[model samples]
Target: MQGKRSNQIVQNTAFLYFRMLLSMGIGLYASRIVLEVLGVEDFGVFNVVGGVVSMLTFLNNSLSSASQRFLTFELGKNNIMELSKVFNISVSIHLAIAGLVVLLAETVGLWFLYHKLSIPPERFDAALWVYHFCVLTAFFGILQAPYIAMIISREEMSLFAYISILETVLRLLIVYLLKVIMFDKLSLYGILTFSVSFFIFLLYWQLCRKRFVETRIKHFIWDRKRYIQILSFSGWVLNGNLAVVGYTQGVNILLNIFFGPAVNAARGIAFQLQNAVNNFSYNFQKAMNPQITKSYASGDMGLMHRLVFVSSKVTFFLTLIPCIPILIETNFFLEKWLGKFPDHTISFVRISVLITIISALSYSMIVSIHSTGTIKKFQLWEANILLMIVPISYFLLKKGGTPEVAYWTTLVLMIIAQSARVVIVSKAIDFKLYTYFNEVILRILLGLPLCLILPYWVFVNMNEGWSRLIILVVVVCISVGLSFYFLVCSKSEQRILNKVGFGFVAKFQALISRYSLNK
Candidate 1:
């Protein structure tokens, strides 16, 4: 059973990584085209305005998290009937949340877009178009969440990957249309973007209805007891999700107020790159998260602890690989990719990459805590720590700090927040803090210097070009691989790696020999 579970994880990770590669390639290219088509100011306008809509969707995030946890937890217990009820309840709750969001967005969000953000007089109309479209997009996205959660909890990662690829291709087509279409580009972009969301939502809804019996909502469920239970869990999660929205979208608004639309363009580009790179860790975590939750639900505390430890270390290493080259060669990559990026884009990308590496370490801990369903103290303290970024960033920008100061503040607060999670998770799960430190943190510290040394040296010694970038990436891969094998990996893990490595080589040899015989 353990072996089967491990194989499932490996297979799912492979599917997700394939999805990530194609999606990342198309996404990076699509972003370049969008920037070229929109230009910096209009791009910034869309980013900040769209950010307002995102801020209002925090409830959706909260509910989505709760739904995933409960669905997966029920599956762990082999409770099929309860799973169906949970799915129905989740769908009903999301519909209500969707209506609430629309109300809030049209009222509070629209007002903020008009009065609070720093848009030019002429572009305000376009920004307003973007705002309304964004709200519509968020509406569909909210409705889509329960289906997505159902798919994930079912471990239908292949379907998830295929749907994701389809969405990316559709978005890429939108970029192409933006380039050729002669309509008001910004407004047209907004309309097309919402169209994509609505279409994707339909796809998920239909797929889930066909694929899973639980997702066929025969009628809306209003189980008052279950409603309170799910809402009570989501209420605490709402605090953490709000803090996330505050630091991310809230800080975007602050940037608009302080530095205007051009700076927002820079920050937006940075995040596009960050999101692409973040998939390296996120895909891995997605594959592991269900297992973590299910294990806890099944009372397999040992397996749950092992998954958390392995996932935490592995996510950090996965994140660090791309980050090293990107940090060292941000200018080269950005210049090559964007051709004419806005001011502060390079600095923002570099700092955001560092922030991603730090944040990667906490994904496992977050999932583990959620799995236990005792997140009130965890969420409360974590929210307090993360929520500090907005006010501190506001004070700094008010005192004339540079645009990058917001990102820097985020980086620092992220570190503090991750430390807080370690402590909270320790208490919540009776996780051994010292064991985590010795196994995960200490090994990371030891292995990181080795991973950086070769990449930085190659980067400094060589001239900047495709050749240099290729060499730097190769050197970093080799460095990180060796360091992880020699230092970071446990003896048992090393043996497993050896087995996989040798097995691959043997398969390659056999394939080559068969090809030679055929020739």
Candidate 2:
């Protein structure tokens, strides 16, 4: 059973990385094109205005979490009947949430965008267009939440990969159109992107209906008891998501007030980089998330514990591989990629990447806590710690702190929050704190410093230019690889790696033999 689960994780990870590489390549190129076309002012306008709408998406994120936990938990127990009911319930809740978000967007978010945000008056109409499409995009995302969760829970990662590729292609297509389209480029990008979103939503809906009976939206399967239970779970999730919205959008708003829209544009670009780097970890997490939930559901604490710790270390390394080099080359990379927008872009990217690494430490723990379905205390305290970033950032900004102070504050606060997450999850599962610290946290600390010494030395010595970047990449890869293999991976993991190595070699030889025979 463990082997089968491992195979499933391998398959999902392989598919996800395939999706990530293709999408990430196109996304990076498209981002450059979009930045050039939109220019700084318009880009910043779109980012800050869109942030208002994003603030209302807290419920969407929360409910997505709520629905996925329930659906995946039901599937783990092999309760298809309950799964279908959960699907219906999730749909009803999401649609209602979508409506609520729309209402909030139209009234509160709209007012905040126009009156509160530091937007220039001339581009107001363009901002309005962007806001309309952003709300449309939000609704599509809300409605499609369950299908995405359903696909992942079913472990149909390849299918998800195909859909992701389609989305990526559409995004690339939008970038192409931005150059050719005669209308207002900003508004056109907004409307066309939302059109793509609408198309993707319909595609997911059709796919889910055909593939899963649970998604069919049959006769009213409403149960007040179950509804209350889901609400009870999702309510705390709402608080947590609100915290995310508060720190993210709230900080954006504060920055707009303090620094203006150009700074927001820089932050937007930084977030794009953040997404690209974090994908390496999150995609891996997505593959293992269901297994964590399913194991806990089946009372397989041993597997759950292993998944938790191993995923923490592995996901951290995944982020580290790309991040350390980027951190070292932030100025060159950002200047090369985005062509100098504002003051804080490089600092933002560096700190954001570093924060992503810190956040990776707690990703699996968040999954473990959520899987246990006992997230009230966890989410409450975590949210409190997380939400404090906004006020702390605000206080600093008001005191004339640099924009880097915002992210520095975020990193420090998140480390605290993430530590809290580990504590909560460990206690929830009654996992050994000493074992986690020794096997996961200490192992990573031991490996990383030793690993960085050689890489950082090489980076410091290398002359400027492509040679330096190439050498940095090689040094980072080799140092991290050897350090992780020797110090981080468990004996079981070492065995697994060796088996996989030999298995691949054997398969390659057999394929060569068969080809020769055919010849």
For model 2, name the residue pairs that clash. Answer: none
What are the Cα lDDT values of the candidates? 0.91, 0.88
> What TM-score does candidate 2 get on C-alpha atoms?
0.97
| TM-score per candidate, chains pooled | 0.97, 0.97
* lDDT by residue (tens digit), candidate 1, 471-494: 998998899889988999999877
Location of the lowest summed lDDT over 10 successive residues in candidate 1: 495-504
Q: When superposed on Cα atoms, how far off is each prediction in RMSD?
A: 2.0, 1.6
Off by over 4 Å in 2: 504-519
lDDT (tens digit, per residue) of candidate 2 on 40-78: 889888888888888998888988998989999999999
The per-prediction tally of clashing pairs is 0, 0
Give the true-structure RMSD of model 2: 1.6
Cα displacement (angstroms), candidate 1, residue 23, comes to 0.9
Top-lDDT structure, candidate number? 1
- Lowest lDDT 10-residue stretch of candidate 2: 496-505
